[model samples]
Target: MTMKESERGDGGPGNGRPDTGADERPAEPAGLRGLAALLRPRVSRGQLAGGVLCLLLGFAVVAQVESTGRDTTFATARQDELVGILSDLGQRSERLRGDLRELEETRAELERDAEGETALEEARERAATYGLLAGTVPAEGPGIEMVVGDPGGGVKAINLLDALEELRDAGAEVVQVNNVRAGVDTYFLDGPGGILADGEPLTAPYRFLAIGDPHTMTTALNIPGGLVKTLQGAGASVLINPRAKVTVGAIRSP
Candidate 1:
């Protein structure tokens, strides 16, 4: 028979040999075939989503608890800090009140103590005092209260400053605008929602309380080129009320 036409032998090559019962073949994975029929399929990408959500929820709860712990839990470090702050403020306020009372008492005693003392009486009578005693002297006079405010809600910082300056130049002492104490470092308005003097918020309907020569202060503030005029241009009224006693207390800035 021609070599090309001959049937290929099953033995290792074209050599003629009977196939052995132990002929080698790759072994099948022992458990895969059986397990494949019984087991579920591999998890898809979306299957991990639920697990991730559970993990994230745990983290979120931790964060919320930490954030709100101060309000929710007492006896914590945060609570102690707040308590200390409040206590300090209270103590300071009380001390100020006590000092003020003592000062007033001292003043009262000084006035009454010198009534009959010959040496003191001679000194007092001899010393020419320009102003009258504050508490004993009745302050009877006409005064003005010019209210400065921003009703248009578009007033500028410079505008308010100009008004206050005009009032001051008009000889306004103890000016209070919009609940703000106009002190040395006091600000009137950087504008609405802004701070003018000493970080005090300048809001609408600013009430300027001034204690000075009432008529003079009023005239000065109400002058054509004065604060009242400037404020009126911005649609704000500068109404002055004359009062006998206008108390201006020392107001602190934040």
Candidate 2:
């Protein structure tokens, strides 16, 4: 009734026991072993270096993208502000230009007014000078005063005319005889009583007021054979006085 050993599965040769003959198999070659180790996945110095470089490159690319995005956002946000600033500056510049133009125009207008005033003042001065020289205006300055009295009635109208000519030749700017203006158009005539100037009879002790250099007028009349000598030669008494101030108050009749 007992089973044979072949029927006992636990003691059989191909049963669940490791094969002892595996150790007796031939050893693999050194080159094959090295090649198999290389083919196997493992961490080495060269592989580690390559993996680190790849990680750094990925991180740099991500950072570059993020930075570029941030810059673009900031630029877009400031675009309106920049445009407004430029617009305001342009407007201010235009206003300044306008103000400058107005100021320049004002300056030019002032210059024109000043020039006109200067021209007007010059014309007034010229008119005043002409009026003074023409005996139309009353003049007062340092000059000579002469008194000629013809007591004997021998003094004629020609003697008065010669005295006027001498006074004019001595640079007399203005002359008045017996309160009458002795201008270029003045005339001397022989009246019934005495000499007449401008048709007005002049009384004795005829006064001659001349506006000029006192020394020049005095020297001119006192020269030998001059107006003073000629008047004295006649019955008229001549007296020349050099005065500090003499006024020719007679104005020419209009």
Writing each residue's lDDT as its tens digit, candidate 1 over 116-177 gives 58677777754422112221222223345666566666566777677667667766655666
Expressed as tens digits, the lDDT of each residue in 1-254 for candidate 2 is: 35554465664476656555656777799999999999998889999999999999999999999989988764666878878878999999999999999999999999999999999999999998888876788889999899999888888889889989999999888899997998788889998777899898988788899989999999999999889889888978998899999988889865
Task: Go through the candidates in order and give the clash count of each.
Answer: 4, 0
TM-score of each: 0.41, 0.65
Highest TM-score against the true fold, candidate = 2
> Candidate 2 has what TM-score?
0.65
Q: Model 2 clash pairs?
A: none
